[model samples]
Target: MTASPERQMELTLPMVPDIEIAAARAAGNLAREIGMASASIDEMAHAMIEACINAREHSGSQDRRIYVKITGTSLGEGNSRIDIWITDHGRGFNVTEARSRRQQLGAVHKRGWGLQIIEAHMDEVSITTSDDGTTIHMVKYGKNDD
Candidate 1:
């Protein structure tokens, strides 16, 4: 299949939760610009923020570094979709433990729901990591971007 036209934006953010709002705002604005509905934009923002928050909480480093990329295409006629990738350069995590924690969404914990929230809001979700770092990938499709 032929590839669709895509645009991408990248950001290198300090591994801090306070700065994630800008990422969400950027994602939301791009989603809207590409015809994503307001609701879908909100969902996209949520997913991006969740990923960033996860990086903030889990990534291990003296001066943590997070890399984020937002990519998407306008599918023509007011339809569009966007993919977001949040990457961190820190000590990786245990895939099994992380997966298990995500599964226990209602465990009465104050947090640990970021992964679940990301999965719920995005159309697709993928996670990959190694001793070097972790990357969380997610996508959202526009219903009526206008």
Candidate 2:
């Protein structure tokens, strides 16, 4: 069955590489506290870090501000899902084009692997872009109900 939406928590941080790790850790911890497995927490954290990095790095400036929002919900009877959204205010690029660029650049170096990694780990992933900014929505499933 399709997952359901629930409460949301939002965070805004300076678009700097140094802060991404911290943000990921905090998010992961929160996820775990809410019933996600350790591995799932790690995976979600990694995905969040990657998404934020892409927003800060390729989106625009090193000083740009990125907004992160997470929502958690109980699925079925014992399952839960968390949705994380990372947004950036910059000139957005096409997801398809971005993948092509990354493929040409290769994943060994600084290629566009964030989306792929996020997709690999998260239960759901969606991207919305406009002149104002771009937002990435990622969903992670947990082990139990609320």
Candidate 3:
């Protein structure tokens, strides 16, 4: 079986209230087009929102902008997967330290759950950060192979 070419969509959003919704909607639409399961689509959308919000709130980007890219790749045999990347050009922080702080805060804090939420919803998640910027990469499979 031959795999189909990847389809990609990109969006650049300014740091603003309610702008994350647009990114989430775009992700959901792409997931749907790629035949991702309904539940997976919802999860992807939620993860997208959390990622976008984190970029906006934590990035401290001088440009005040976030770049999002969603790519759908066919795995052949009716299987597909969606990969998303969210990037911000700002002074990066230590993810490990942040996670440790969040764990320490636990239920007392009402915020700082974006990374956790994204991890819970996406099939796989990885983050790359440096003084230059941070980029979050998330992936979700279209079907439950198990």
Candidate 4:
């Protein structure tokens, strides 16, 4: 497989539990096609799943949509990076606030671990919230240095 000079794909679908699997598969396929390392792709796929699960479980039940945009770029010589944006159309919350609350709870709940897991795996994680909704931007490092 050859990596495209420009590697990118966009997927938009209903924010439902079942659809997350499709998204994960799509992401993994892209990673392999673009020559991303297996371990990096696996971590990225997991991050995407966690983000989508949050959207499906915590977001409103109806009329909710998730948009996924993935871009793979050659950073330098052989190094590459993958940027993934997962946006959900639902009532927005402050990511920082939610994280703080979860931490302060001092209890371990699987539900609140989604963001933490995503952050831990990805090279960079950013959360943007607005009246429209919330967007989670995650980036993973690829094997190639250029």
> In model 2, which residue pairs have backbone atoms overlapping below 3 Å?
none
Q: Write the per-residue lDDT of candidate 3 for residues 1-146, one digit (tens) a residue.
A: 65564789999999999899999999888877767778888888898898888889888999999999999877866677999999999998789876665545446767888888888898899999998999999998877333
- RMSD, candidate 2, Å: 3.4
Model 1 lDDT vs. the true structure? Answer: 0.80
* Superposed model 4: Cα runs more than 4 Å off: 1-5, 101-109
TM-score of model 4 vs. true structure: 0.84
lDDT per residue, candidate 2, 1-146, as tens digits? 76555555778898765778977877776676567667778888888888888888888744489888877776756667788888888888788976554454445567677788888888888999876789998888877523
Name the Cα RMSD for model 3: 2.9
Q: Better model by TM-score, 1 or 3?
A: 3
List, residue by residue over 1-146, the lDDT tens digit for candidate 4.
Answer: 54444588999878755888888888888777767788898899889999899888776534678888988876555567788898887877768766664554555753577888898789999998876778899988788512
Highest TM-score against the true fold, candidate: 3
User: Residue 110 lDDT in model 1?
Assistant: 58
Rate residue 58 of model 1 by lDDT: 76
Which residue pairs of candidate 1 clash? 35-145, 36-145
Report per-prediction Cα RMSD to one decimal.
2.4, 3.4, 2.9, 4.0
lDDT of each: 0.80, 0.78, 0.86, 0.79
Model 1: per-residue Cα lDDT over 67-111, one tens digit each: 888877887767788988999877878766765664344567656
Model 4 lDDT, full chain set:
0.79
